[model samples]
Target: MLVGIPLDQSNNTVKPKECASEMSAYIVEVAETRCKRSFAKVFNYFAPRLRSYALKQMGNEALAMELVQDTMSNVWQKAHLFNAEKGSPSTWIFTIARNIRFDMLRKLQNRKEDVCSDDLWPILCEQTADANEASLDQQVTLEQIGYMFESLPVKQKAVIEAIYIDGKSQQEVADELTIPLGTVKSRTRLALQRLKGMLHDND
Candidate 1:
């Protein structure tokens, strides 16, 4: 009962109850050689469904569209990995979509946790100190820390600020900075290391 848009020999689109195996075979063709028509057929059939699925999960039209685009791009790239014997084409594509959605959700959760994290400023005051002394120590320590942070390399400083101060996930920072996630992580790590060295030298 699966209704699909199938292209006939005349290049006419027809609604047919196509078997999943046939669709999978077409994907195999796409894998072996780049076939624009075959891919178009697959895109026509699956893109809207993937979009709807993403919309329901993400609840944002723009993000859902992005999800669909990313999922389809993955499909095109990984077409060779699709095995009909292991799973149907629909199952494989939906699995990719599911994984993408899960990753997005995980990143969103990370951003939320980062927003609430206390790691932005180290606890520098002794608990044994009086309240007034602790307050003054904290103020001085925070000022020094801020100065050190500002001294970091521009890219490193930007990464740390986005992640820790702005509560943005690494992915968000990457997108904002037009850099890769690995770059964001590397800059943050290097920034922290340099900041630690500066603090140690001062002490």
Candidate 2:
């Protein structure tokens, strides 16, 4: 969807610029040439994502949308300052969004808070809990290695799974599989090499 309000309000305000470049450069030229339609189109394209990003950081949808509008307005007014050679259009636009977010946070800090301190603790704890869950998830990923170990040929897969996943020694796996020690070693090595090649080829 196009971002922000419809172009009916902003397009008629500017003239069109010639040629296209990065988004930042395009925005600058559009504003300079008074290309109202182009300006509105560009604003719409970027507004939704920008709003979502702002809201994620600020925890307020309305405020984020306001910031998106403000950022677009700034883009129109300050397009001339954009330098295409230095960065991509999206990067430049995002930088503007980021700056706006930081400014809003700073402004919020100056105002007195109405909410009780106890009300904020849950939100803070939620954030902390999210971090903890993510850490636990990393340790849980031992199963991915287990799955990879299991998904091999019966002998090759069995020997590797027994030795690695099941915590058996090489001699134990060989004895269990009733294969020679050297045969077990050879199969494990060949299986690993083939797995690596398959993975690299997939990439």
lDDT of each: 0.75, 0.67
TM-score of 1: 0.47
In the range 30-51, model 2's lDDT, one tens digit per residue, is: 8589676567767766787688
TM-score of each: 0.47, 0.43
Cα lDDT over the full model 2:
0.67
**Residue 199 of candidate 2: its Cα lDDT?**
52
Candidate that would win on lDDT: 1
Q: Which pairs, if any, clash in model 1?
A: none
Q: Would you give me the overall lDDT of model 1?
A: 0.75
Query: Which runs in model 2 stand beyond 4 Å of their true positions?
Result: 1-25, 111-203
